[model samples]
Target: MQTTSHILMIRPVQFGFNAQTAVNNAFQQVNNETGVQEKAQQEFDRFVALLRGHGVDVTVIDDTPQPHTPDSIFPNNWISFHHDGSVILYPMFAENRRLERKPHIIGKIAEQFRIGRTTDLSDFEAKNLYLEGTGSMVLDRTHKVAYACLSPRTHPEVLKAFADATGYETVEFHAADAQGVAIYHTNVLMCIGDDYAVICLDAIPSKEERKYVEEKLKGSRKTVIAITLDQMNHFAGNMLQVQSLRGRKLLVMSTQAFSSLTPGQITELSSFNPIVHAPLDVIEKNGGGSARCMMAEIHLPGKG
Candidate 1:
């Protein structure tokens, strides 16, 4: 299936900006420290409520205050659940971020979902190589393709290992912002949906690379919805298509991202699925991740 009804979200206990991720995540901005955690928690709750209101089944796990993982809210980075009853653990770049991957959380999920073998790629972190789960690669599950932009957080060898293990074809490319700095995560620059793809072609400066990516998407029968660099800065490409309980398709993103969309882009995207957005200013600014990053899609079958 292209979309999943189940999603996993980590509730922040000590939610704040992290210097570790900010090294490469230009989207993050450190603002006043006053009430940041409260504001972020409020935004997180509202986002969860908004998703639930739209019929999305969300599994929310509260972060432990003891470990102090500031970026724990974005669970898609360290772990991903698969449809074939497989759970894949990824190698995170940040030392603190690695703490977000709790074995107990997977144990809790296993009670409801039939989890089979686990692919542990975390060992690569010892060699200074990393691939931060969905953050490193935007997956077109239906086509079995993993589109990744090379970066420090996304290593080619680790990506190839993931592709080999999952039987996914890797489409690698280099993407950067206007300043020529590499984008921290592929999820920030592109999203692959069931029948459509939202991407910032401008980020892939090389004509040959852009053409390769475009051709791959076209060949996969995806309607490309190209977002400009400015739009990408507003998180326009960070969208996720999910199935509601009633099987309705909903595209979830931040309100800022939604507002950045052109009328034509909105019309074309809405033609495929209804758009669902919530205010995420605090989270986006501090976390460097928006709605798509916050959600880890659960594709595992039920224990029954």
Candidate 2:
């Protein structure tokens, strides 16, 4: 199981201009009040400190100034680490995002974990197929199941390749955003942890598909914490569960997600795990992603 402590993050150098995400990420901006670079650093520092305070061992890498990857803050979309020691590099739909996959980043991680193999699925982009890593799919690592919502941004071929390489079963569905447009990434609508799942069922309008997902979660012994469309708009469904240093569990989300929750939802969730949140107004407004996007959990076995 992956915890917040065992995660990786990249500090953004050019945090405001992501042409790749701009195609679907209308939320990003360059604020005059807060310089892009300064704001990113401050956000990174606070995020890291919060993770560490909860006993998460965070490995932070500075983004290189030469090759600017504006959406570098959302590394989970580019790469993923598995318990089997295999690292999968995804095919991002965005040209700029494709550059976010750096071999050096993998090399740095190799110092602490054994990398049995590296699968490069980025070549599939030539065929117009993409699977933006964890952003395209929320994985139930313990069960080896990947829940994917198909859209222009998430191709089935790439999802199958990941499943074949990782030995995971695929649960595919179609989801639309508030405007009835296809939701760009799967991570924004759901997160699966050891004992629970937070999801926006309204996003999956199909009655059958929603029932299937709900049944699957129940079958897996996961307590379902459903969020409303309004809460989902506030990014409430984008929460992740991780273990703290003391082995206690924490359900991590942004202040926006926390504030969007109802008193009943918060009380129900608190029964499973304590909730932890950090302010991500600037990051969310400009990056179009929140806490879950900022982290790439490391589930690889230790080298030693």
Top lDDT hit: 1
Query: Which lDDT tens digits does candidate 2 get at residues 186-233?
Result: 888998878888999999989999999889888888989888878877
Q: Let me know the TM-score candidate 1 reaches against the reference structure.
A: 0.99
Q: Per model, state how many residue pairs clash.
A: 0, 3
Looking at model 2, residue 255 earns an lDDT score of: 90
Off by over 4 Å in 2: 2-4, 26-34
RMSD of each: 0.7, 1.7
Model 1 residue runs over 4 Å out of place are none
Compared to the true structure, candidate 2 yields what TM-score? 0.95
* Candidate 1: tens digits of C-alpha lDDT, residues 6-25: 99998899999999989988
lDDT of each: 0.93, 0.85
> TM per model?
0.99, 0.95
Cα lDDT of candidate 1 equals 0.93
